[model samples]
Target: MGALFFVKHKPTCREIDIVKLTIYTDYSLRVLLYLASKPDATATITEITEYYNISRNHLVKVVHNLGIHEFIITSRGKNGGIRLARPAEDILLSDVVRKTEPDMDLLECFNPKTDNCVISPTCRLKSMLYEGRSAFMAVLEKNTLADAAGPITQAKSGEAVYVNISRLKR
Candidate 1:
């Protein structure tokens, strides 16, 4: 074989410092971050869904949670939709992630003793993941919605503010 190389099917991951939270976590943040970038700005759920090309079904959950978590306010009117509840700078990135993440457990092993995997009783993996998690949260804590978002000025026609993995980079 010439220049043969076997690549392990490792899952591709985002290069951002924070560990992948979840699609729930991911979309929730995107909703807020998008609106935060447009503080004093608002968009309909349909608008956001169309701009992101994400299923409205999926975004509805995120938008609902944002409403429940007090991260955003929704208005029912032909001229209104959703807007950031507070100034973007006031919302901490860590806070949003904390509220959005399903569970804090970094690994399954953290749960009650199960699966006699030789090192289960003495493995430092759990603690290590914890430490890493803390560090990750601390990094995100340093940035606020404002930092994650761009300044909100005037909403221009044909102007889209939603951000995507491809639009932004690590």
Candidate 2:
């Protein structure tokens, strides 16, 4: 008998990373946090930019979108600035995320219009991912800007103290 050989095919599907918020959402949250930290005062874009050490141009767009969504109120000219349109306690994190994120689809199969997966119709993975995403949103829905905008902590150098995730593994 002739020798027979078989080859196993590697999956062509890309390995998608865990769900993440967009930079716009991050900036929006940061702006809101900065504003919430100073409840009695209005903040200029320049001030916010300087405080976070982020891009002014990007912050401008974020501020505009926040204003359009009625999350924040903005005024122009001297003595004019931005302030929260509503109390931080009333602004749910999930609402901000939904409004700012252009797309929330975790996988291609999540969107039927663009889904081209051959196994999508019978895929349990899609349903599992949907459940995971729902759980993620549910957690966010339970929290508000007030819960996230706790006291600001800074280093001795007056810089934001960022957690080192790798160190936490120990």
| Candidate 1 residue pairs in clash (backbone atoms < 3 Å) | none
Tens-place lDDT digits, model 1, residues 92-154: 988887887766654545445433345656876667766876887787789887767654344
lDDT against the true structure, each candidate: 0.67, 0.76
Across residues 12-81, which tens digit of lDDT does each residue of candidate 2 receive? 2355564566677888888987887776689999998987799999999999999999999999888999
- TM per model? 0.74, 0.80
* Steric clash pairs (candidate 2): none
Clashes of each: 0, 0
Name the runs in model 1 displaced over 4 angstroms.
Answer: 1-19, 113-118, 151-170
**Lowest-lDDT window of 10 residues in candidate 1?**
1-10
